[model samples]
Structure formats: C-alpha cells, structure tokens
Target: MVTYNTMIHGFCKKGDLYTARRVLDRMKDSKDCLPSTVTYTTLIDGYCKKGELEEAMKCMSEMNKQGCLPGLFTYNALIRGSFNKGDIKNAQKVFDEMTCKRDIITYNTMIHGFCNNGDNYAQKVFDEMTCKRDIITYNTMIHGFCKNGDNYAQKVFDEMTCNRNMITYNTMIHGLVKKGDLDTARRFGLNEG
Candidate 1:
C-alpha cells in the first residue's frame, strides 16, 4: 500500500495525473489493501495539479469518511485547488481552518495563484503574510506587475533591497524594455548577477 501510494505521488509529481488516477483505481480495486491518507493526498494533489478542484474536494471528503486523518499536505492541496480555480473565498476558508502550524510553501502557492490572476489583490496577500518572503514570492508579484503594467509591482522591486537575485534583475530589465525604457533596462541589465 505504501509503494502504491508512492507510485501515485511520483506520477503526480511528473504531471501525469492520468497515470496517477489509474494507480489510484488499482489501489481501490485491491481487496488486500486499504487506502491511506497518503493515497488520498496523492490523488488530491494530482487532481489539483490538473485543475480538477471538484474531484480534489471529493477526494478530501472521501478521505474524511474513510477515517483517514488529513495532514498539512492534504489541506495544502485543497487550498491550491481552490486558488487555481480562482475561488479565493474557498481558499481563504481552507487557509483559515488550518491550525497555527504553517508552512512557507502554502503562502508561496497562494502568492503564485494571485499573481497568475494578474489581480492587484495579490499584493494584499503578500502584505498580510508575516512569513518570510523568498525570491519566488517577489518574482511572482513582479512578473505579474510587469505583465499587467501595475506600478505597484515596481514599488515591490524597490522595497526588496536585501535579496537581489539574478531573476529579479532580469525581470526588472525585461519590464523596463517592455515599456521602451531602454536606458533603465540597460542599467538594470548591468545589475544582473
């Protein structure tokens, strides 16, 4: 059962949600095995990655009904599923329900979701997170700003003076170039390290 769960996880990680589902079905058919939380988690993750939020929620419900305890990963997957579907309300509900224990990756996933939407609300999420923000978090918002021509994104770049990564420099240069600010782009390109 453990190996089966791991196989499903591997398939999901490789973005082969279809194969993951097939493995899950095989697990379900096996009389000798009982699906664990790991099994449900793998299936939920696979569904989330494939943007099948309804199916992912079903997996969550079934996991509970089967008396399998959900861990952080299960909740994380559901949160991401909701976020991916642009259901921020549901995502917030899931987030609010999580106990005090938190992971940085959960916040990062939410940041990415909001950024991908090109909505200004992403910045609010960033502002509210007390967890240490990493390069990916900054980059996601920066890219979103550049994509949407939101000046607020530029303000974030100005605010990030501590961890100036190469991607950060490159994104700024790309943003400037997009706006026909060749001089600024050249200056930013020189800052790339």
Candidate 2:
C-alpha cells in the first residue's frame, strides 16, 4: 500500500496526472488496500500546481466521499491554487470550509494571497491566528508589504518578538530598497553590521 502511494506521489510530482490517476485506479481495484488521505492530497496538490483546479476539486470531493478527511495541508494547496489564479472568493470559501484547526501555513497562505491581491486581509488573519506564528509568518507580511512598496512592512518587523533571521533582515532591506527608501534602508543595513 505504501508502495502504491509512493508511485502515485511520484507520478503526481512529475505532473503526469494521467499516470497518477491510473495508479489510483489500480489502487481502487484492490480489495486488500484502501487509499489514504495522503494519497489524495498528493494528487490534489499536483493538480492544483498544474492549474487544473477542476480536477483537484473533483479529487477533493472524492477524497471526502472515500472517508478521507482533507486536512490543513490539502486545504492550503487549494487555497494556494485559488490565490495563484487571483480567485480570492474560492480561496476564502475553501478557507471557511476547513473542518480542521488551521495552522500557521493556512493563515500564511491567506495573508500571501491577500497581499498579492492588494488587500489588507493579511492583517486580519494575522490578528486572529490563535497559533504560534514563526518567522515565515512575519516574513510573508514583510515581503508582501515590501513588494507593494508599503512602509507598513516595518511595523510587522517591529511586531516580531524573537526568531528574527537573515531572511527577515534581507526582506526588510530589499523591501526598503524597492520602495526607494534608501536612507531608511541605509539605517537598516547598518544594523546588520
């Protein structure tokens, strides 16, 4: 069963959905083993990454019908695919439909999506997250703000209590430079010394 799952994952990662589906079909034929949630997730993620959202959604529905509970990782992939296509409505729909507790990755995907869409939704998600946020969370906001040329990235930097790393510093510097805030960038760059 594990081997079957691995084969599915390999085909999916290779973006050969047909072969992946064939492997899944073979799995379904065997009475000795049942496909797991991880199997469906790999297929959904592959389809989403390939921009085949319809197929992904179908797999998601099938996954649920097969008694496989789609978890945060699967939900995140769907949200990301929606965001990749600038479809916030669908993204939010999937987000709202999440039956499991969301983690930082889920919120980060939302923030990154909203940021890419030029909305302030990230702030709301950032505030509402009940889980412990890591540097990736902070970096997402900072990078988003910097990409949008907004000085608000600095405020997010200020909010980080600890775990600041080179990525954080580089994002801030790059953002400041992108926004033409060279003087402020200089001040920040000096801090890195």
- Give the candidate number with the greatest lDDT: 2
Off by over 4 Å in 1: 7-34, 83-89
For TM-score, the strongest prediction is: 2
Compose the digit string of candidate 1's lDDT tens values, residues 84-158.
788887787777787545577787877777777766667787888877888888888888887776666668898
Give one digit per residue, the lDDT tens place, for model 2 in 1-193. Answer: 8898899889988889999988887888886787889889989998999998888899999999999999888999999998987789989999999999998789889988998888888889888998888888899888888888887888889889667888888888898888887887888887741
Residue 109 miss distance in model 2 (angstroms): 2.0
Candidate 2 accuracy as TM-score:
0.87
- Clashing pairs for predicted structure model 1, backbone only: none
What is model 2's C-alpha RMSD? 2.2
List ranges where model 2 is wrong by over 4 Å. Answer: 178-180
Pairs that collide in candidate 2 are: none
Error of 2 at 58 (Å): 0.7
lDDT of each: 0.81, 0.87
lDDT of 2: 0.87
